[model samples]
Target: MVRKNIIISSLFLGLVSASPLHLKRQDLPIDSYDESVAAGADSTDTPPVGDAVPQNVETFDSNTVAAEVVATVVDTPPAVAQASNDTPPDVIAVNLLKRSDMNVARADGPATSCIVRTFNGPQVSDPDTPGAFTSYPAFSTAAIDSVKAANVPSGYAAVPNFVNLNAVAQDKSYITYTSSKLTSYDPKKCAAICDATAGCTSFNIYYERVPLEISKATQVPDAALGCPGNADAASATLIKCAFYGMPLVATSAKSVYQYQGKAFKVVYAGSTAFTKSSGPTVDGLQGPVTFGDAAINAPAPVIDHGYLRTQTFGTNVPFAPELCAASCKAQTEYNAKHGTNKGQACIFFNAFVIYKNGKDGVFTCNYYGTPYGVSYAKNRGQWDDSGNHWTISNSFGYYVPGNYVAK
Candidate 1:
């Protein structure tokens, strides 16, 4: 794919309505990997600023990049309050690295790998019911075991690369949710749905306590007509599956308020989350290596060691690291032909999904001239006072092997 040069004049900004929730950054043990390269006085290592013009480059895939800049809009629940800060809002910022290179291969199909986990939680029930709502046994385990005991549904075979991420349903970046009345409580089925859905990378399956019917009145035969606010209205259990566009993390699976009203208190039980094991592969790149949940934070080998360019992809295009690889490769070729860089080329790149206000909105790729290891992957994300919460997920870095030998 060939792309036209994209001039990045200024950082794009947008507003989102959400309560402020800070996520602490996770620290990872670093392995000893020296990425130092000799720097000369003439080398330009300073990172690019807002005025920098970036070259729009093509990816290995035939998918066309969106022609216009895309803005992501987050859906806010009515029950949540808008964010408020005691101090002035922090400026939205992201650290960027210099140029890099990698070759990427087109993916054949949706990721086939998957994993599953079981969670022990309490079920929701009426206080006046025959039995009390107690701790639900390993809900996921029982569900999987029951499925195994019965005939396997056609096309619902286990995904080879599926892996479990958390014991609870993730509360972020959900596209939409449906109940067992529409589908089933089968993880395999949910995985299949995510595989087929564009931009869906993970899924959560659980049982939820919901009102049989919503009514405003206090006394009525059928909740469909009228039900009192006595809180004893009949409740039903729904096997719901929520799909997300990014990997699910246990940290975001916080079990707080699930949605409660005057007559009903919705609660979740036996939640489990699954994510894709890997990303698209480039032939020469050393990785699609996981950076845990952070972006690369490599120090400049030289003064000129900052990122060559940065590109953003909206949710319409699924997270594809190969696009970053291709952009890195393209930047190198452009530099060579123009005799711009003294002898440097793009040697590494980082790609990840960024969630805006709890929804997967942007897929970002940053190209670098110096290659760094996972130890440098420290920048997680930040919250902007604009009421937009930024979070990083499924971050990976790709690098070309060998030291930077300038041509």
Candidate 2:
């Protein structure tokens, strides 16, 4: 009877241990087993009596040392195997390198002094001062032709900024400005030409519409089909690029154009180089020009159209952004009485220009009739990484009208 009782107890213990294998079966890595079995290892189809059998298991008894060895061989968690195998090689290398001992450097230099100075265009011949305003050189017919001839098979001459053939005729007659037409049309190519030429600040390109049959055969999108006034691609009569010496003054004429047979309706007309000394002059303001508080969400001051202008009084005082602001305010008051554009009240003070020397760096305080606050400096002036020099740019400011007029 005691022997029978011992057998029964052993069976009961085995059954209790076997129940855990069934419970943990879901966590087994099936791929490992299939691969091991295919690789010709001996293992049972059924699980062991006391524990789950690992893939290609060599022995069944826990007392056997080989069984422990087999367990150790397949000890890797399934998730660990998957994660290690699926990761990209580069990602793995990055992680491994990150684990190694390495240090990163940071800037700890002293803050740069905000000194103010003035500069004029290097090529400007008038006033004999570096910062004084001068007339921009006009483009010659030969220069324009040189740009057109350089166009290759795969590039454009000028790109659309905001172009309209009708507007050009109505507001700014090409007759007033120096203009030359290209025998062929390419927006990027024209722009590249302007970029290459110094006097060629801005260029405009016009395209004639494509024929209806060609448009339908090309399967062009509706937007590219044409515009409202000039609705058909074929209706386009001309495709020409015109370079301007000054900012195209904004007129009461509407700013609209249509796709003749191209993707864009407006080719950019802004200049790559300085168009004029400052912006075009208009009436400043009527009555007392009170400098108001620096505006909130101030519109950035732009040149005549979208160009740059400034008066670089030869570098005298230490450069500071505030100095430029003060100078502009003073200039506005001066203009009110004796200035050429007397009514002009606002001015744009830009201190960020090319830094030349320690005491006499490039800076300017330009006067304008209107004070449009800067939205954001397109190129936040800073150190030029390529040139290894400190660069400054217009940060922000607004028109102060009727404020305590700087004496």
Candidate 3:
């Protein structure tokens, strides 16, 4: 059968949080994979940084619940190094290479980069779960026939192509999947399993790893223990984003026990809350705060890469970034149509302010809403009217708090 190998490189980006005990950083949305591609593990790598702060007395859960301003930890990766050709599962990040071209007649052919395949290796598949051997869905061959329509990156390396880097997994949490018999199943089912299980914020979908030729007798062992005698042996893993949860269809948890015997739990909703005054303790980071909102004016050119906000100029129409983005997006689309910057427009979110808490520990977002249209720095002096610099711009910047993981 024709198959595609799906891999991802661990492009480790760090996160600093406004709070940790509550596990902040929800606004961050790194690219996952293309809409349809599956993700894989790192074969080569580096690692960590600062400890996570305490999470009040509760937990952070992903359910539709609101948590408090808990402490957060930042991840700092070591410099990059060449990956070993036959690296171990966790040794390096996952990478997807283009295999042989496929038959054009087979509509949902290999061309659809979204169709994913995982690395052949040992895995702890939950035999009872429907997705024990899950695979990326064959969305549509349209993507395949559409590369002729893809917008190549400005300076992409000779590599084929990649879409959503945000979808890929940034954290590695332990897991235990239930099992079932149907080898083929819906991914949503697995998501449900995790969701219903109190603290399962996420889930993993496993398909047979490559080198499937190995005997079926040891297929389980092979996956669980990884290929025979490889020192780098470890199960290949990826994250599942599905909103709903599911039940595993192929394998069941070997033990009703916890992963590595560690207790399984999720961060409870609304556990912690932070105010303008107190932010989380980030390593090497000071309390200096910056509150940002989108400013809306007519569409303007994007000058740099940072948080963006906009304010309207004609009268007092208040602020809205989504509307600005829509306008900006439209302008970019226009550029594309007019052969101008073709699809290049700078749109900031609604105008918000960053509360620059200075070198001190004081911080707040608008810290005060209503009234005199939010505080403004006439100049960078004392809430004053002198040597100003932080000019509360006509447009506000997007609020991008650093990533925060609890210690």
Candidate 4:
């Protein structure tokens, strides 16, 4: 009986050892085991006792045993595991922390500052009222003579014809004027301004006495009691640079006037003028004769000789007649090479200034194959479809004289 009992105990122990209670090694797929090992889980390690499967993982079943086992065995936090589905856990945490810190920093910072400023307009002064001083403090006969001796500025030469008109207290036709109150008494500045103006051909520099205050008294013929004019009022001397469309002439300088008797004399002094003499000169071109305010309207030389083309210049380029002459010569040469008809050569050109709405607009050059006399200059101007009026002035004609053969 003892032998039989011992044998029974031995058989029971062998049966318990043969059939283990836990899952068999082969029951979990080899691929699942390998994946679990790849995810920081050792093949020899097992899930902690009583550990629940992550909520993000699918429910365990016979078909999904390997995947569920992998989710269970991998040492990952639930939140990190969920986030790892779309992005790396470390990257997600870092980006979220950075955005939160930036928001908090902006909320705690100071507000931005802004500023606005306003400016007042210029004051208008009257030229007729008298001020404190009786005469100009800066005026002297020697200074006037010195300015006359230095007739022209550095880049300009004296207009030999109008030298007699210098140092005269007269106002001529001017397109515009700049006061020395805005700048210094500089003739070079005036010349530069004239060079930049579209139709300015000359400039006049002068000193004029202006009153300091406006007269509030009643207008009376008697000069003693009431403010008749600013002649006797305290005055300020202003140097004026005036630009003109044409050269200075003796006829235009005869400006003489009196206001409220001669006690308050509005006098002018230290008057000087200048004109631009430097320009391009073309050979064999004749007659830059003044057409006054008209352009050439000539008939064709033959059937083939007539109007060629028109060119317009801007304010930067001065009214240069040689530019038109050069273009005419070029056109003649081009026709000699490429023209199909005989006598089809550009032999003449008209240079003028066009005024738009009574202001200088552009410098124009019109080319023609045939020559026209100044008497034939009949085109003043006309109106356009847009109702903008254009008129021509300061026109001059140039031509090749004595049988201009195209070669």
Candidate 5:
């Protein structure tokens, strides 16, 4: 009975110890063989005991590592670059590089001290002065062709002061004057008189005409645009005569300026109320238009920007920008047909207009003459990098920089 109890205990323990694989491998833990396992193997497709066991896996490769590394790098943030420091930090000093030489009134009776302000036309000429403080030589048409040539330093002696701004229109047409005489040449009043009067188109506002006492030569008046300095006497009366027909617009401009150029409608200089006359007298040429009214309906003139800002193709503005830029054709045209009806082709465009009018359905561009524009256009091809690439221009002119568009 004790032996039987031992056997039962052993069987229970073996059952407890047997794993699933062991149970599947064989009905009994031990291959007590006597049951003929070989026969069972031949009869079935099942494995017995530990035969045909499973094995463990070991290694991998390199491409997978590289792919994982790339993924991680792509997920990370990139480094930021540095910023530019061109702009000033708050308050900073800057030089304007521009100076106004307006010397208001001098003892020489306003004739010798005041700066010459308003005038007609783009042509400027300074009479030859020999022993004078400044001598603007005999200016020919060639000088007028170059705007840089026209850019006389501000307050340049040729652009000197004037006193006794006394002007007179004699013979109902001639512009003549005496010292401190007329006492007034109100440009506004003159404009009014022009509007009221039919035959009137201009007024000879007076200022002292001081000639450069050119040695071995003749004294002459400084005339801006058209009138060149010739042999004339000190008794010569200088008059500023302006005419009509332009409220033209600008297409664009360049540099530190606002898009629209500065414009002052009134022709004569100074306040609206005062008109002083100063100078000597002379005759011959179309004299000033005559009328008594003190003011008129005159549109203001735009002050043009005198620089160039074109690209490899042409001017920066797409509209009528062509009107205001420089060109080789300007020189050619000026040299060619100067004596014709068009006279001189404006070398630079001081002003322009670009728009379609409902009345006309067409765009209009005008190149008002510019002393600086002409000069810059001629020289720009050498200095402005973009200017050299284009074909030689067959037109005349120069332009303003900043572009202005109004819808």
Candidate 6:
């Protein structure tokens, strides 16, 4: 057996929402790894103000779903940070290295850097009845492998990836009201489970921790507990998957339940896809998207070191900050060739993974769909405007066409 020792670091990114219950920056703890990657510099680290230009970029899979926006907190590392480094179940660890490697293959993979498998859900017209629990399908490596083809609608994209959430207390109204639980919960199959059930819309996948009691009947040895002579110890956690079609409204009775139990962590919260009459659109297609310089003011929602969106672009395309913008420019033409309704054209562009090589700090192009949201300059400032001076990095200057009409 090839023992794959997966090391999941506890690296979490913060999220800010446009909702009333906003996520503060402090709530989002920073990680050293992310900072190192963001801090890398290249030749165009800082471009002169007004020198940066927009470039064409490609589109990514997108849907204009309602923004419950739990902020799929991208976990930089896996949740199970065990000291013993025991090999986890193969199904759980295989997709842990979720992002597609630009260095190797570009075949179908997870939508985000986080790896969570999407499955072909049973197309039930309605969720199963209330008070009735359903079992998630058994784990199958073959079933997972079949869906690994690119550009196909595998209902998997509907699943959201959340990191480091606490387990839910069973007494919580939402959990109590949910009433459906599945043993051997797999986050990868969350989408299918929710869809198969009647009235089901959202679900939470989490690990449930239980305490070990060393009574006469249940003799847990010290070696097993990792605490010799300790009467009380916690047993290894069990993962539980809960499904709910109802919205977790912020009422007086419900809001408190969010923080109540040891089982309160949330691995993923999935909802129906974002709906839009038309697909994602570039808000402003400004031209001459420049490369490398210092900035007067940069836009919001910057992609400093996001995982490369696709393997083809990352491997075949040379490191060019303007590659995404160039892809965006040719989008209209691409759309003409491949039906605008198809939404195959690139909607957003980014240049990431900056590194220094001699005089120039080089970076590569990445494409994306409509982001959950975007930020422009405040107070009518077009610092993010085209031909404006927006800082890319300290060493080199690059700009992502910030304006987008996301779904």
lDDT score at residue 193, model 4, on the 0-100 scale: 80
Pick the winner on TM-score between candidates 2 and 3.
3
- Estimate the Cα RMSD of every predicted model relative to the unseen true structure: 17.5, 36.1, 24.2, 41.7, 45.3, 24.8
Q: Flag the better candidate by TM-score, 4 or 6.
A: 4
Q: In model 2, what is the error at residue 247, expressed in angstroms?
A: 4.0
For all candidates, the clash counts are 27, 52, 118, 8, 47, 59
Q: Candidate 2 — which residues are off by over 4 angstroms? A: 1-165, 169-181, 207-237, 249-407
Consecutive 10-residue window with the lowest summed lDDT within model 4? 91-100
Q: TM-score of predicted model 6? A: 0.21
Cα lDDT tens digits for candidate 5, 141-232 = 21222123243222111111111212122111111111222324334434454334322222333222332221111111223321233433
Which pairs, if any, clash in model 4?
128-230, 130-233, 130-234, 131-233, 131-234, 132-234, 231-264, 232-264
Candidate number achieving the greatest lDDT relative to the actual structure: 1
Better of 1 and 4 by lDDT: 1
lDDT tens digits, residue span 93-151, model 4: 00000000111111122222111111111111343332211123233332244246474
Q: Total clashes, candidate 3?
A: 118
Superior candidate under lDDT, 3 versus 5: 3
- TM-score computed on alpha carbons, candidate 2: 0.20
lDDT of 5 at 37: 22
Ranking by lDDT: 1, 4, 2, 6, 3, 5
Minimum summed lDDT over a 10-residue window in model 2 is located at 88-97
User: lDDT per residue, candidate 1, 312-393, as tens digits?
Assistant: 5433334656556655665566555543333348788777766655543356676666776777777777665566566677
lDDT of 2 by residue, 3-94 (tens): 11000000000111333322221111111222222222221111111111111111111122222222321332333322322210000000
What lDDT would each prediction earn against the true structure? 0.44, 0.26, 0.22, 0.41, 0.20, 0.24
Question: What's the CA error at residue 78 for candidate 1, in Å?
Answer: 45
| Deviation from native of the Cα of residue 73 in model 3, angstroms | 18
TM-scores of the models, in the order given: 0.50, 0.20, 0.21, 0.38, 0.16, 0.21
